[model samples]
Target: MPRLLLVDDEPSQLKALQRTLRGLCPDLHMDLALGGEEALTHLRARAHDAILADLRMPGMDGLTLLGQAARWQPLAVPMLLTGVADFATAQRALNETGIFRYLTKPWEPELLRAHVCAALAEFQHRVTQQTQAAAWQAEQGVLSPQELERLRLEREEPGLTHVEWADDGAVLMPALDAHLPSMPR
Candidate 1:
């Protein structure tokens, strides 16, 4: 069962989420946070598989909390729960927060559960890819000095570095550090 952290400023919202998700995802262990501060506290205390947060809140808005939380646990999937119907807010949620999903208010349990399932599935897929890639690298040859340098550069500017490394037909996301065998000096 995946652990889920729910953060919202409103008690009513918290109650709503609890009631909505109770029978929907019985297998999930839900942790409650009244605000961003409390949410960060819980996030540090335990490792939750996913987080659901309200967009509009006092003291550390959802975007900032999500960004900071990403640094804390790069793998913790985030989903934003908000009633804001504005397109700009949705765009910001995607670009700034990197949210897995922006769930509108009056959520259907099934839909929320579906997003949870999808988020977990995506995380699992990435973990699997990283593990497999690591094993493959271990079984293969070492990275040359030039390749190592390329990686170092990629760590700096991922987008441009990826293009620089694209000729080798290897591409990766920012999170996973792919291993390349050491090239002969």
Candidate 2:
């Protein structure tokens, strides 16, 4: 099941945001936090696919929360929502916190839903790719330096290695065919 963490100081705002996205994600396990500290506690306990936080909070701001969240759960997609639109803060959120999206207050419901869905999809893809790589590595233990580099590159930009699989559970190497002479047509 996909998990989500929502953080806001205002209870009403948290409820409203939760209500808006309740019907959007299927079997969504959504968690809410009253403040950044509570959100961090949740992060330490479990992993979330996405995190949406209010920019203005009592102790820890959204940017700070997300920055710490990234350290705890690097794969979770972070988003910031704030009524105040400050360019400097937005820039810091993007550069330092690595937020996926920055939303202003009174946002359109449709847009918010779309952004959340996109973030979830991206998170799922990352998890799937990581699993695939781990499986591949386990099958072929003690990979060489070059092969390790390829794996790293593939993780950074998926499909970079052009990996193919055969029906018999073997890796296909189509490029090798060009170097050998054909026996029969």
lDDT of 2: 0.83
**lDDT (Cα, tens digit) per residue for candidate 1, span 1-185:** 66788999999899888777775544778889888888877766666678899989999888888887776566678899887768898898899868898988878878887887788777667556655665565557565556655544533332233332356677535323222322479
Residue 18 error, candidate 1, Å: 1.7
> Which candidate's TM-score is highest?
2
Question: What's the distance in Å from true for residue 63, model 2?
Answer: 0.8
User: All candidates: CA RMSD in angstroms?
Assistant: 12.5, 17.7
lDDT of 2 by residue, 43-90 (tens): 766678999999999999999999888765666899999999999989
What stretches of model 2 exceed 4 Å from their correct place? 136-185
Ten residues in a row with the worst lDDT in model 1? 174-183
Off by over 4 Å in 1: 23-26, 141-185
